[model samples]
Target: MRTTTHAAQAGGEPLDVLIVGAGLSGIGAAATLRRRCPDKRFGILEARSAIGGTWDLFRYPGIRSDSDMYTLGYAFRPWTDPQAIADGPAIRAYVADTAREYGIEPHIRFGHKVTKASWSSAEALWTVTAALAGGGERVLRTRFLYLCSGYYSYDEAYRPRFEGEAAFRGRIVHPQFWPGDLDYGGKRVVVVGSGATAVTLVPAMTERAAHVTMLQRSPSYVVSRPAQDRFARRMQRWLPQGLAYAVARWRLIAESIFLYRLARGRPALVKRHLVAQAQRQAGPGVDAAVHFSPSYKPWDQRVCLVPDGDLFQVLRTGRAEIVTDHIARFTERGILLASGRELEADLVVLATGLSLKVLGGAAIEVDGSPLDPAQAMSYKGMMLGDVPNCAMTFGYTNASWTLKADLTAGYVCRLLSWMDRRGLAIAVPRRDRAVASRPFLGFTSGYVQRASRLLPKQGARKPWQVYQNYVMDLLTIRFGRIDDGVMHFGAKGCLP
Candidate 1:
């Protein structure tokens, strides 16, 4: 492994590219940068002692990838496990392996938390301020700064303020930051939220807890399928490993796209089928109205994915129950429902959704002037309009995160190559007056909608508005010309 001191080597000061966060996105960024700019010096600053970001941080029981590993895994690297749905440890191991294989481990500086980054027009660089793990603060200057820290606030978990929350005597925990010493054996546990986290928690907790109750404000559309694809296995036996992976990836992508479109075009039909499936698993005499009815239209919010019906199996056995109601208040012993009933609980798990932040809460300043991300438009879903030589990546909410991440990475590589060949110092996206635009992230989920005002706007044309279709993204980001419209290239040493 290559190692270097904190200070630059005796060679001419390296053109530094500082990346914050050592999670999947951060590591992916490092790999992409190394492949694109072999001579540029880059460093990854991670807040935690380890890598793996979300996968490493979340260790609650039954924690795993919500999406199938076939697509969730890195694009360049194919997942070789028989089971497409994998547990947290397995995912973490894959991430660690990727870092080691790419020699990115040595580039990562553990326990370095970036507090703020300010841009300087005079130097055309970013001054980053970070707090070290042991003590004291350190400052570093970088030619370019990449914020791959993700959207969630690592320090705080989103726990809605419920009435009489302080009065609850039972142990309360947020799934985002599960305590290592927590013990739920032989206790009645109630997990709140209808998202992926809650669905994953109930079944796993029920094994040790006497009973597990999943409490939610409303229902979430849930689906289940086999953890392993029999066809994928059959093809693997006959075809090469890479060929099998390619077939499986394309097959899954097509199936998902078709199903998603069907759900969006015909909500009633999809809702009936989904509810019926849930009923089949839940069995007769259960209140499907309360347990399966969702207020919003299908695809309005992301549907939860469960592997091999594990959650439904738990419900079918009566070890776990779903209660959909308005939470009135928290009693000393448990949660009080608005229906004038108390659900007794020994342990409460808050699986509530995450609070969204832009650019992982990093402040964006250009030429000593604060830049408002909301006022800007997203160019190619990677770079913000008017932001020069800067790009940020956000993955798909419905599909595998790496699908979008990979596309963005490829596009950034192409952009960098163009700039280098032309001797350009800055590449900024310029808005075309002839075209109409919309908000970049148009999802209707409460968490995303609440923060839409802070997100960048999207263009009506291609590359500006994110193409959720993977095939289209492949053509535009991977194979299309980098000198397309809306991209403005400035000569070296040019300020604007």
Candidate 2:
């Protein structure tokens, strides 16, 4: 790793690849790059002082992986823990350990928050600018820019204001920026939103709070699975460690794919099964249809996961309640619902969703022209149409994020290798004007819908389409041809 940070080292001499964000995708990208393109110069620019992006950022109670660890864990690393559904700290440690194991820690530059990147076709390089966490700024250049900063803003969360908030006496908290000194013990807690966060918080807060209520405008589909994978444990007993891990990983992947396909193919059948399962899990009193059954089909938005029916168990205990009603206003003691019901609470948790941020909220330009992501089309769900020498690591919406992130990293490495072999300087995905454009993501989720106009569009065909399937992505991105005619390559001093 380069130790110097002078203007020349920072900006003058260009790196082979510059990765933004040291989170899950960024760390995985670095590890992949080190293995695939060992000799290439690279650096990871992390805005925060530490690694473990999302895991490190969120410190809310019972913060854990919604996806199973077997699939969420990196392709190269084996998640050997007995618990398949690991918590936030464990996942963060796993990521940090992966970086240490791959010798990626040395290449990471902490406190460098990337602000903007200007791509010069003439120089075949990107002039990147980042703000220092302490003070001042630093400029750097790279041949290829890989954005793994994630799709949501870390600086701010999607926190919608409620009427009469100032009149409320209790403290209101957003899960994104959870307070370390918060004391909700013996207090009536109300968690807003029926998303993954709310579900996780409801059961967790019930442990300490007098009572916890999950208040949602609408319900979300919830799936309950064991915390530990019995099959994984059995595999560990029968097979060697590596082989066992591989088996468990593949098993989970296949199961998720099958389940997703089933849900999509037969939404009504899956919906009925989910509702019935929730009803059985929650026991007699709870109305599954009224609280657990989502209006949208499964996988339309992400299905919330509750390990070992934790949420349902809490609901069964009567310590937690799921209320489906709009918030009319914040009352002095609690919240007033649209149904003319009032729920008294001492504390409120806004477990609302995240705000979508494209490219870590960094500005991108090509030939001194700013790139509007909304106008540009996505290429293979990673690169933008007409955007040269750049790739963004966006994961699958339907499956574990790492499943798609790993494939994306591998594809970027392949692209780099292909360019190296051919002595090429630039590679850009040329847009096919004939192809019809569609939304980047196919979800009715509020966050996605809100950011619809800000996101890039996907084409109706392969190479330009963003398939949320891991199998298709693994086949095409990992094994498919690099020079598929869509991605135009150029030699030095030549623009694609």
Candidate 3:
């Protein structure tokens, strides 16, 4: 990858597009641009030295994708691997390999942490400022700016301050910052949170830890599936790699849509199925009602996936346990629950959750006016209101993230091509004053709720509304009209 900050400074000419964050979405955007908008020059700016964003950063034991790889993998590049639920390092390798295969590495500017981006109405260009590695800075101008920085903040994880935390003698760790040299072997570990991270950790750490307890205020829905996709394996044997992968991808996508639709339309039926599955996994004697049940309906928040019923096996083997209770405080030995029960732990893993951030908390300005994402309404869930020549990719909440990301990239390519052909200098979505606004995300998850007010608003109508459905997005993004009434496209000093 290119270590320099910006291409303009190195060559004295601005790029056609500047992509932020060389993670899954950014890399995919580059590949899409290379294919669809080959005439336009683009550069990717990543803060870290590595290519993988989430996969590379999260180094905790048993870190893996919650979504199956078939759906998570890029549409252009099929994942030929057998594993549906792949680990962090494996996924990281897959992403890095994709970058190399597409020849996207050389256009990526590593160690360029974006601080701010400003757009000029007169020039119809964006001036992006980023910090360099050695302590200097670089400024680059571009006609279009695409942000794929991911939704979560990289600086810190969501760690709630526990009462008497300072008094606790045991080592406290957050999964976001897992220590490499620290050993948890033979130690009693108490992991806080009932989310995906907590479930994954409790089972994996059981092999090395003396005992692992998943301590949470309430239970989350957990379902088990095989790690490998047997159907995908069989398809590969009969069909070509690309064709087999497409079939598996679509099959998984259809199943996801079906399940989510069921959860939304008939909550009681899906809830019963989920609870019954948990009951079978927990076995006869254990009280699944007390330990496995969730208060809210399914799909209100994310459901944790356990591969091959591994978490269930660990629970049955008595290597791990789940404690559903409120944390009273952190005691000298361990955590004290509200039930007056004390659970001792030598090491405490706080897998609480992620801290969400919009645009990585970077400053954005348009025509010397400060811009707030919250004040803007989303157009097609990517471009914000009055945000000229900019688009940000945020993936689906219900399905695989890449499903929406791939669609977003393809649409952006179309937008760029249309602009180039028409000789248009700028494009921005104009939110009608008559339209009503709603929360960007419909979910009631803690992280989302906390950041709701800070996030961009979504309208109730098409082009401005947010739908997590991949099929709808596929048709809309891939074939939607470029001159939609709401989107203003024009040359500088011309009618918009």
Candidate 4:
């Protein structure tokens, strides 16, 4: 929205807050700041030209939100769409519309990719350096820096090389960078991986391709739900739109919490239910044990969602199939599996996973010393330990991402307000030396495990712990005290 970078307009005056990334989290953070702390001047620096971060970037066929829109949608803005499982373009438009509605567009500086943020205790400011799209550098200073750049790299997708990838004659595509003009119609397609992307692609491509085969080393949990919420629709007819939306949101949130708890508390029962559902939906020919059941328990990795049983429907129709085998290599015709079986394909889609990155790959420095997110313990799942005047929104691993992001934004606003009332310049989390550290994410997914060393560590105690539960975070972040003993606050040049 804003054509020029903030540095050009600041005129040597630092902003009250500088938010990185104009994605879902960043936009939500800006809107929250405008509503709660209107007196503070803030600017959003977006690396890309578009407003929708993930939605705008991903253009693969059948690209849709894995999570239901009721919970994924922002709390302030109620999702009025009839389809609870909305597509990428619709979600992108929703984000852009929110920005316009809140008058948050004008404060956004597009194509200003933040490279580094350095905090100075003496000045109590964060000097941010960004690379402009037009090939120039700009510097901007701010009192507080908020990062919502997301957890993964935008420039790269997790593309693993096959043993003989170069020998393959057909075109290989990564879903992250889907080619617009390429046609898969009447072609045999083999999609690699069993994650959300692969699940989405297999069903979507089956409609156009001659046949689609989902090739994976192991199976992931897949669940099916209706696209529209009948209850939500009925609620909208009776109650006010906002109230109806809130009710639906809460209902979905409660169901999620209950299901997650059930899965964790009674893994055997939950797994049996999931496998039974899959077996029934997948029809007779499909082997549920060989291709549907996952080795690990539910929630160990993200469960893939197939709206309206679209994936199973495709499988039953005989347009698509799932192959549970390891890729021995890429042959001249297709992929050769470890079972000495060869699957022929005209096109290969590698929907492996995402490559995770911390702080949008921006280097962070505190008082001229480099700050490694891996080394720093996560405080309240947002702020890093001993890191002053900064907060990053890392969403819930179990539920919808926006649930935690919204809470994080609200907490940041509360923190700023508290500091203002007390005339404080800096607020940093002080990790207790006694608290033990654990992996930031408990997910056993390939992406999470690969980026374990790149992510921040979570603490064992309260306030320092990253509880993936929404209810717990809601109480702690929204209603909790700001001057908790774990967080130390002070003025500039008088460090706490």
Candidate 5:
């Protein structure tokens, strides 16, 4: 790996593209750009010292993928590892490998946190200001800026306020920032939240901790599957590696569709099965309805994926327990439940999800006017209305993030190639006056819902509205024409 000393200023003049965040999206974008435009200069700016964003930051026990590795893995690369549901360290290694494989590691500028990006119409360039890790700032000018920084707020950890929280004497930890020195061994632990993080953490912590109690306000649908993909392994043995990857991808996609359909069409059957599974693990006489039943339909809110029923297995072993209750306050020794019950805990883990922020909290402006993302419409779920030569890649809440990200990257490459062929420097998404739409990301999760007002609107027709289906997105983005009505192409000196 090539490491550069932190310079007071950028080494060269304006670059062709400036990518923010060295995570999966940033590295993926760099690989895509290199393939499409070898003559252009581009660099990646990362805030942290490492490449893996979420995977590296999260170190809590059982920090593994909620989605299968087959779907979660990159489309261009085949994951040869046996474990389909990979852990944090393994996933981080894969990310590092990808960066090294594509020669992206040398181009990445670590400890460079982007603070602001301002667009200059006259220069047709973006002036990006970033704060270095050690304490100083540097500015870079680029022809185009791509934000792959994701939507989560890394610095801001979510911890709900309970009355008398200050009175609690025990140690408190947030899974977002797990401390290495803190010991949970032989101590009673209470994990808050019913999300993927909490579910994963509870089982892992129970092994070391004396006892673990998962506390949740509302129940979430949980499904368990094997850690290894049997079909993926079979295909690898029977066919070529490339063909096996393709088959595995299609098989996973088909399975997702069937499962989603089964949940939606035969709600009772799916619900009964889920309840039975929970009961079988929790044992007879336990009321599975209160802890496992959710108010919303399955897939409405993401169903937590447990590998090989590890969570159920933990419950069966009686090392951990689940409690559905509203927290009234924090006592000196434990949490006071709304039912006037006290749950003692030596340590508390707040896995209460994440706070959503758009474009990694970067300000957006258009023609000297501050752009309101809430008012803008999402053009193909990638670009905002009237935003020129820019695209923001966000993944799916239902499926694997790479599924949408890979498609978006391919589409961006196509757009760049088209612009180069026509000698065009700007391509903006034109706002459709007749299109009546809502926020770009429509979801009820507290974090996503809070930012709904700030997100762009989706279109009613194809290409504009994000079709979560991978096959459809592949065709629309890869095979479709560049001169689609939603996107407006312009020459170097032309406006609009």
Candidate 6:
């Protein structure tokens, strides 16, 4: 984490590629490029000091992957862990290990945040301005730019304004920036918001807190599964690690796709099944209908998962409870409900959600003209329309993020290889006016709905649309031809 930065780390020659962010997507891209494009030189610029993005940033109690590690893990790497749902620290260590194993650490430049990018038509290069972590600046030039920074804001999570919050005497905390030394032991804690964070926090805080209460305006669909993956265990015992991982990954991906489709097409049937699963987990003491039943369908937002029914166990033990009502205002002792009731809490955890910040708030310019990322239509969910020699790795919302990221990285290498063979220096998606614009994402979750307007738009037609399906993306990205009619490829100053 060097702070003294006058220039972009002294690169004598222009880099073949410059990847932003050292997280999963960025590291994966570097690994793919290293292997596929062995002759090209590249560097990864990471804003943070460490590797793992969400896993490293979030230190809140009970922070764990909502999805199974088999699917969440990279396609090339085998996840040997028996636990399907892994905790934050373990996941972070896994990412760190992956980086070391793939030799991507050498290409990483930490404490360097890219602030602006200006592409030169004459030079066929992108000159990037990055702010060094401490108090300096650096400039780097590369033929291709890859933005792997995740969509959410790193500086702050979404925090909502509550009435009379200033007068509240209890400590209010957001899970995004969990205090290192804050102690909630033996305290009556209340977790607000019914998303994954609130569900995870309730069970974790129960072991230490005197009493934990989950207060939500409405319920979210939550289903509990065994922490250890039974199939993964059996497969690992019989088959090789890599083969077992690939098999389990495909099975889970298929199951997830089937379930999601069912939820969308036959929402009533899917909703009933989920509700029954919740009731079975709750047993006789707790009411699943009151706590687990959401107004939306199963996949409307994301379905929260509780490993081995930990949340239910805590609730059955009387250490935790759930209350569904709107917050009228914040009282000195606690929060007042819209129903004229008040609940007391010594500590309040705001599991509100995330703030979406696309491209880490970096400014992009092409030929001295400012390029608004939001205005540019997305091309194959990886490349932006009218943006040449640039790719953005955005993963599937329904499945593991790496599934799409790896595919995107592979396609990028393919494109680069093709361009080199043809002596071409640039490739940009030329938008078609006939194509109708659609929302980049269609999820109705609060965070997404709030930030959808700022996100890049997708086209209604093929090659320009982003299908969240892995199979479609595999054919569309991994096996698809690089010379799509929409993409313009040319030598330096040859085509304008």
* Backbone clashes under 3 angstroms, per model: 1, 0, 0, 0, 1, 0
Scored against the true structure, residue 448 in model 3 reaches a CA lDDT of 94
For candidate 3, lDDT tens digit of each residue in 253-330? 999999999998998888888888888987874567887778888999988899998888888878888888999999
lDDT of candidate 2 at residue 320, scale 0 to 100: 93
Candidate number that wins on TM-score, 3 or 4:
4
* Candidate 4 vs 6: which has more TM-score: 4
| Per-residue C-alpha lDDT of model 4 across residues 375-428, encoded as one tens digit per residue | 999988989999998999988878999999999999999999999998999999
Writing each residue's lDDT as its tens digit, candidate 6 over 1-496 gives 2346565453557899999988888888888887899898899889999999888999999999888889888787788888899999888888888899878898888888899998887888899988888768888889999999989989988999999999999999999999999899999999999988999999999989999999999999988878998988999999988899999899998988898888889999988888888888777777778878888877778888899989888887788988898999999999999999889989999999999988778999988889887788999999988888999989988878888899989998999999999988999889997899999998889998999878999999899899989998998888888887889987786544
**Which ranges of candidate 4 are over 4 A from the true structure?**
1-11
- Please give, for residues 77-138, the per-residue lDDT of candidate 5 as tens digits: 78888999999999889888989988888888898888877766666667777777877777
For all predicted structures, in order, the TM-scores are 0.94, 0.98, 0.97, 0.98, 0.95, 0.97
Which scores better on lDDT, 1 or 2? Answer: 2
Better of 3 and 5 by TM-score: 3
Error of 6 at 49 (Å): 1.0
Clashing pairs in 3: none
lDDT of 1 by residue, 1-496 (tens): 0223243222334345777888888888888878777777888888899999988999999999888888888777788988888899999998898899888998888877777677665566677767777775566777767778887777787778899889988999999889999999999999999989999999899899999999988898888878888877887899898888888888888888888889889999999888888888777755665687687777888888888898888888899998998899999999999999899999999898777778877677777778888878777777887777776778887688888887877777777777778777677777665657786665677678767877777888876777667777777778888878768777545665
* Candidate 1 segments whose C-alpha is farther than 4 A from its true place: 1-12, 120-122, 433-437
Error of 4 at 2 (Å): 8.1
Displacement of residue 394 (Cα, Å) in model 2 is 0.7
**CA lDDT scores, all candidates in order:** 0.81, 0.91, 0.88, 0.92, 0.82, 0.88
Poorest stretch of ten by lDDT in candidate 1:
1-10
